[model samples]
Target chain A: MNVLEIRGLSVDYLSAGGTVHAVDDVSLDLRRGEILGLAGESGSGKSTLAHAIGRLLRPPAMITAGSVVYHRKDEQVDVLKLAPKALRAFRWKELAVVFQSAMNSLNPVMAVGAQIDDVLRIHEPDMSRKARGERVVELLRRVGISADRRKSYPHELSGGMRQRAAIAIALALNPEVIVMDEPTTALDVVVQRDILHEIRTLKDEYGFAVIFITHDLSLLMEISDRIAIMYAGRVVETGTAKELHRSPRHPYTLGLLRSFPKLRGPREDLLGIPGTPPDLRDLPPGCAFHPRCQSAFDDCGRVSPRLLPGPHGEVACLLNENTGVEVQA
Target chain B: MRFLARRLGFYLLTAWAAVTLNFLIPRMMPGDPVDLLVARLKGNVDPAAIEAMKQAFGISDANLWVQYVDYLGNLFNGELGRSITFFPTEVTTIITGALPWTVGLVGVATLISYLLGTLLGVLAAWKRGSWLDGVLPVSTFMHAVPYFWVALALVFVFGVTLRWFPVSRAYGLDVVPAWDGPFVSSVLYHAALPAITIVIASMADRILGMRNVMVTTLGEDYVVMAEAKGLTSRRVMWAYAARNAILPNITSFALSLGFVVGGSVLTEIVFSYPGIGSMLLKAVENEDFPLMQGIFLVISLAVLVANFLADLAYVVLDPRTRQEA
Candidate 1:
C-alpha cells in the first residue's frame, strides 16, 4: 500500500518577472516501508516538490494545484486541506523532513539534546521531561551518536555528527514517512555513505518509508527500492532501481546515469548532459528536455508526451509513443 | 579569564582617552572662566580682588602642564572644583543633585522604549506585510521628528491643552522630593510628558533596526528547522528567531542606556526639567569649565562602562563569540 500519494501536483513561484513553474504536474507514490529515490539535477524542482508536499514552502512559492493524500491504517488525510492547528500536529508526527543543509539546520544556540527534547515537548506533551531526555538518548544512539555528544552545539559537532543529530530529531516522534532532501549532500563521501547506510538500517528496523531526494543517481541506485528521474519540474521516468540502472527508458534518465563514473564496469569517458536546465518561467514549447535531448526527432519539439508505460516502467517522451505499451494515467 | 582581563584593559584605555579629551576640550575654548566671571560682576571690582578671586577659583595663570596635573589630581581626589555660575558650590554636588532626575526619567523611558520597540519589531518581522508592518512608516515618521519638537508637541497637547500633566519642572513646587508616595507620584506625574516624548522619539530606531535584523534572521535554516520540527509559531519566533535577532539590539540598547546619564538635552531644555542635560546646558552657557568637564566626564565614563557591559553580554549570549574569545 502507498504511504503517500501525490496527484497532478503543480507548484508555482510568483517572482518579479513572472510565475515560474517550479514543480509542474508531477505525480508519484511513496509505498510503505520503501525508499523512493527522487533523482534530479539542481533546479529540477525535486526539493520544491518535497517542500510542497510537506507544506513548508514560504511566499513566492505556492501550490497552484495539487492533492497530497497521506494514507494511514485507519484513515486518509488530504494534507492540503489541513488547518494550521492540524497541520502543525500532522507535521513531524506523521511526516517529518530532513533538509538539504541538515548540518546547519540544527539551532546553533541550542544543544542537540535540547533540540530533540523540544520535538518531544511539542508532539508528546504528556511525556515527562525525564522520559523525553531518555528518548533523546535512545534516538541519538539509534543514529550512531553517543549520548554524551548530545550536549554539544551544532558547530561543536563535525558535519557528519550534525546530520545524524538532524536525523535523530526527525525520528524523535517516529513519523511514518520521512522526506530527506539531500540530507548527506554537504558531507564528505565517507560520511555520506555512513549516513545513507545508517538510514537504510533504521528504515529496516523502524518500518518507516522514506522519500530520499538527491541529484546523485549513483547513491540512489545503491540504496533506493524504486527511483524517479525528474527533469525540469516533471518526472521523466520511474522504475525499479535495478531496472532503471540496467536499462533506463528515458533519454534524460540515461544521460543522468552516464554522468556518474562506474567503479568496476568498462571504463568510458563521463558524458555530462549538455546545456543547463531550462528556465521555468519561459520553457520550450514542448518537451522541456528537447533542447538538450540528443535523440530528439522532428516531432519532439512540437509535441509534449504524457507519461506512458513501456516494458520497464513509465517514460514521458515522444519516442515511447509507438512502443505498444499502455499509458498509465 | 584572560579574555575578560583583555576586555577590561581595553575599557580602561578607552576611559583614559575619554577623560583626557574631556579635560582638553574646555581648556581649548577661547574665553577664560575668570573673564566671564569678571564680565558678570561688571567693571566695579578692584583688579587685586579679581586676581584673588581667580586664584581662589583655581583659574589663576599657571603653566598648561601644571594645570593639567592639577586637573588630573583633583579628578583622582573626586574634587570637581567650584562651579562659576553657582559660585562656591562644588561641581560634584550640582551634578549629583541633577543626576537622579535624569537617570530616573530618561533611564526608565529608554528601557520602556527598548522593550516595547523590540517586541513590536519581532512581531512586525514575524508577520511581515501585516498591520504592524503597515504602522512602521508612522513610527519612522515619529522617530524622524526633532526631539525638541516632539517634547514641545507633547507639552502643548498634554500639558497646555488637556491641562493633565505639569508642563515644567521635575515635580510640583509644593511637594518636596522624598521617599513618600505623594512626592514620588507628583514627580512621576510631572515627568510623564518628557518621558513620553523621549520614548516616542527613540522607539522608531529600535523598531526599524530590530525588524531589519529579525527579517534576515528568520531566513536562517535553523529557524526553518524549528518550524519544521512542528514547534508552535510563537516558540519558533521568540525562542528561535528573536533569540538570535535580539543580540544586535542588545548592543544598541546598552549604548542608549549609557546616554541615559547624559540625558536628552533638548527634551530637558523644553520641559525645564532639573536633569543633567539642563545642568550641562547651563554650565556651557555660563562658561563654567569645572561643571562642563564634570558632566562630560560622567557621560564618557557611562558610555565606556555600557560598551564593556555590552561586550560581556555578547560573550554570554552568543556562543560563537565565546569560542572565539
Candidate 2:
C-alpha cells in the first residue's frame, strides 16, 4: 500500500526578483515499509519537496499546486487540505522528520528527557510525568544512549549522540513515515556508517517508510530500497537502488554516480559534474539538464523529456530512446 | 558552580575598576570641591567653620593613597557620609528611603511592560504581514523616542490637559501617612502617569526586539522539527521559539535591574518625585564630590550584582551554557 502519494506538486518561492519555481511538476509515491532516497544537488529542490510533504514551507516559499495525501494507519488526509487543528494532530503521531543539523535541533536549554516529555506533553498531554519518564528511558536505551543522558543538555552530547537523540525523539510518537534530510552529514565516516546501520535496524524493527533526502548518492545507494534522482526541481529517474548502481540511464545520474570516489576501485581521479545545477529563479528553457548534458542532440535542447521507463530504470534522457548511443559509464 | 564563582570574581574585578575610576575622576577635576563650597558659604560661615566642614568631608591633608584607602574603608562600613545639599543626611539614608519608591514604581512598571511587550511580540510574529506588522514600525519609532520625552508627553496629556491625576509627587498632602485606601489610591494616582510613561517608553523596543528574535528562532530547524512532531503553533511558539528568543531579553532585563537604583533622572525631574535621579542631579550640579562618588559607587555595584545574577540565571535557564562553562 502507498503510505504517501505526492501528485504534480509544484512549489514557488516568491522572492524580490520573481517567483522561483523550486519544485516543478514533481510526483512520486512511498510504499509501506520502503526506504526511498530522494537524491539531488544543492539547488535541486530536494529539501523543498521534503518540506512540501509536511506543508512545512513558509512564504515567500509556497506550495503553488500539489496534493500530498498521507496515509496514517488506514485513513488518508490531504496534508494541504487539513485544517489547523487537524494538521497539528496529524504531525508526529503520523509523520515525523529528522531535519538537517540534527544536533542543533534539540533545544540547548532544555534537558533531553524534558524535551522528549514536551513532545508527549503537546501530543499526548494525558500521559503522567512518571509514565513519560519511563517511556523516555526506554526510547533512550533503544537509541543506545544511557538513560541518565536524558537529564543532559544537547550541548552535553557528541554530534552522533545528538543525531541519535533526534531520531529517538522522531520515533517517540512511532509515526508510520520518518523523513530524514542528510541526517549523517555532520558525522565522521565511521559514525555515519553506524547511524545508517542504526536507521536500517530501526526501520526494520518499526516497519515505517523512509523518504531519505541527501546529496550523498553513494550513501543513499547503500540503504535505500529505491532511489529517485532529482535535478532542477524535477525527478529525472527512479528505480531500485541495485538497478541504479549497475546501470544509470540519465546523463545527470551517470555523472553523479561517477563523481563519487569509489573505495573498491583502483586509484583514479574523481569526475565532478562540470557545472552547478541551474538557478531556479532564471532557469534555462527546454530540458533544464541539456546545458549540462554531454550527449545533447538538437532535439534535446528543444524538447523537455518527462520521466519515462527505459531498459534498467526510469529515465528522463532523450538519448535513452532507440538511437542507442550507450553511455553506460 | 565553579563557572558561577568565576563570573563572580570577574564582576568583583569590574567593580574594583569602577570604584577606582570613581575615586580618581573627582580628584582629576580642576576646582577643589571644598574651596567651591567655602566660596558658596562665605556670608554664613567663617574660615574655621569651612575647615571643619572640609575635615568632615574627608578633605584633610592626607596622601592620595591614604585617601583612596579611607574611601574604600568607608564604603564597606556603609559610611557614605553626609550630603551637602540635604545637610547632615547620610547618602546611605537618602538612597534607602528612595529605593522602595523606585522599586514599587518602576519595578512593577517594567514587569508589566515586559509581559505585555513579549505577548504582543509573539502575536505580531505569529501573525506576520498583517495589521500587526504595521504596529511594529510604529512601536519601533516609539522605542526610538527618548524616555524623558515620552514622560513629558504623558504628563502634558494626562496631567496638564485632562487633570485626571496628580502632576507630581508620590501622594497628595491631604492623603496623610496612614497607608490606608486614600493614601494608597493617591500614590497610585500620582504614579499612574510616570508608570504609564515608563511602560510605553520601554514596551516598543522590547516588542520589536522579541519579535525579531522570535521570527529568527521560529525559522530555526528545531522549530520546524517541533512543528513536524505534531506540536501546535502555540506550543512551537512558546516552548521552542519563545524559550530560545527570550534568552537575550532575559540578559538585558537583568542588566536593567541594576539601573533601578539610579532611577531615570529626567522622569524624576519632570514629576519632581524625590528619587535617586533627582538626588544625583543635585549632587552633580553642586559638585558634592563625596555624594557624587557615593551615588556612582552604588549604581556600579547594583549593575555588577544584577549582572552576576544574570550570569547565574543563564545557567538555570540554559543547560547548554552550564555544560559549556
Candidate 3:
C-alpha cells in the first residue's frame, strides 16, 4: 500500500528574473514501511518535491499544481487542502521531516531533551512532565545517545550526535512517515554510515515509511528498498534497489552510476556527467536531459519521452519508447 | 568563574578611565567654578572671604597633581564636593534627589516600549505583508523623529490642547513627596505626557530593529525545524525565533537602560521635569564642576553595569556563549 501518493506535482519559484519551474510535473509513491530513496543532482528539485509533499514550502515557491494524498489505514487526506490548524495536527503526528543540516536545524538555545520533549508536550498534552522527561531519556537512548546528553545543547553535541538527536525528534510522535532530506550530507563518512545503520534499525523496529532524499546514488543503493532517480525536476527512473543497481534503463541513471567511484572494480577512468543540468527557468527543447545525455538519438531532441514501464521498473527515456509498455506522460 | 573575573576587571579599568576623564574634562574647560561662584555674588564679598570661600569649596592654588589626588580621595570617601548652582548643597544630595525621577519615568517608559515594540515586531515579521507590517514604517518614522520634538508635540496636544496631563514637572507642587495615593497619582499624571513621548519615540527603533532581526531569524534552520516539528505558529514565533532574535535587542535594551540614569536630556528639558537630565543641564550652565563630574561618573558606572548585566544575560540565554566562556 502506498503511504504517500504524489501526482503531477509542480512547484514554481517566483524570482526577480521569472517564474522558475523548480519542481516540474513530478510524480512518485512512498510505500508503507519502505525506504524510498530519491536520488538527484543539485537543482533537480528533489528537496523542493520533498518540501512540497510535506506542505513546507514558503511563499515565492508555491505548489503550482497537483495533489499529495496521504494514505492511512482508514482515510485519505489531501495534504495540500488541509486548513492551517489541521495541517499543524497532520504534521509530526502523521509525517515528520528531518532536515539536511542537523547542526543548523536544532535550536542552539534549547537542550536536546527539551526539543524532543516539546513534540511530546504538543501532541501528548496529558503526559506528565516527569513522564515526558523519562520518554526523552528513552528516546535518546534508543537513538544510541546517552541519557545524560539530553541536557546538552546542539552546539555541545558532535555532528553525528546532533543528526541522531534530529532523528530522535522526528520519532518523538512515532509518525508513520519520516522525510529525511540529506540527513547525513554534512557528516563524515564513518558517522554517516553509523547514522544510516541506526536509521535502518529504527525503521525496522518502528515500521514507518521513509522518503530519503539525497544526491548520492551509491548511498541510496545501500539503504533504500526502492530507488528513484530525478533529473531536471522530474523522476527519470525508479526501480527496486537491486534491480536499479543491476540494470538501469534510463541513460541519465546510467550516467549517474558511472559518475561515482566504486570501492572494488576493474581499474577504469571515472567519467562524470559532462554538462550541467538545464536551467529550470529556460530548459532546452524536448527531453531536459538530452543536452547532457551521452546516447541521445534524433527523437530524444524532438520528442519528450514519457515514463514507461520497463523490464526493471520504470524508465523515462526514448530508448524504452518502443518497448510495448503503457506510457505515462 | 574566570570569565566573570576578567569581565569585572575590564569594568573596573573602564570605570577608572571614565572617572579620570570626568575629573580632567571640567578642569580643562576655560572657566573656573570658583570664578563663576564669585561672579554670581557680584564682587560684594571681600577678597579674603573669596579666598576662604574658594578653599571651602575644595578649589585651591595648589599644584594640579595635588588637586587630582584630592579629587580621587574625595571620590573614594563618598564626598562629591559642593554644587555651585545650589551652593551649600552637596553634589551627591542633588544627584540623589533627582535619580529616582529619571529612573522611574524613563526606565519604565523604555522597558514598556521594548516589551510592546518587540511583541509588535514579532507579529509584524511573522505576518509580513499584513496590516501590522504596513504600520511598521510609520512607527519607524516616529522613532526617527527626535525625542524632544515628540515630547513637545505630546505636551502641546495632551497637556495644552486636551488639558489632560501636566506639561511640566514630575508632580504637582501642591502634592507632598509621599507614598500616599494622591501624591503617587499626581506624579503619574504629571509624568504621563513625558512617558508617552519617550515610549512613542523609542518604540519605532525597537520595533524596526526587532522586525529586521526577526525576519532573518525566521529564516534560520532551527525555526524552520521547529515548524517542521509540528509546533504551533505561536511556539515557532516566540520559543524558537523570538528567543534568538531578541538577543541583539537585549544588548540595545541594556544600553537604553544605562542611559536612563543620565535621563533623556532634551525630553526632560522640554517637559521641565526635575530629573537628572535637567539637573545636568543646570550643572553645565552654572559650571558646577563637582556636580557635572558626579553626574558623569554615575552615568558611566550605570553604563558599565548595564553592559555587564547584558553580558551575563548573554551567558545565561545563549549556550554558545557559555561554551566559549
Overall lDDT per candidate, in order of appearance = 0.88, 0.85, 0.89
Model 2 CA lDDT for position B10: 95
Cα error, residue A121 of model 3, in Å, equals 1.0
Retained true contacts (fraction), each candidate? 0.68, 0.80, 0.79
Over the stretch B1-325, how does candidate 3's per-residue lDDT look in tens digits? 5666788899999999998898888778776777877678896888998888788788776888898899999999989988988988999999899998998999999989999999988988999987787867798689778777777888888889999888888889898999999999999998888888888998898889999999999988888788877899889999999999999888999899899888578878999989899999998897778788899899999999999998888888888877744
- The CAPRI category of model 2 is medium
- Residue pairs that clash (backbone atoms under 3 angstroms), model 3: none
In model 3, the Cα lDDT at residue B41 comes to: 85
Per-prediction tally of clashes: 0, 0, 0
| Every model: iRMSD | 1.1, 1.2, 0.8
Q: What is the lDDT, from 0 to 100, of the residue A301 in candidate 2?
A: 72
lDDT of 1 at B271: 91
Candidate 2 Cα deviation (angstroms), residue A289: 0.3
Across B1-325, the per-residue lDDT of candidate 2 in tens digits comes to: 7888888889989999998998889777776666887678765777798788887777766888998899889888988878787777887887787767777887788788889998898889888989899877789789789888888888888899998767888889887967699999888888888888888998897799889898998888888887887777787888888988888888878866777777567777898886777778888898777677788888889889888888888888877666544
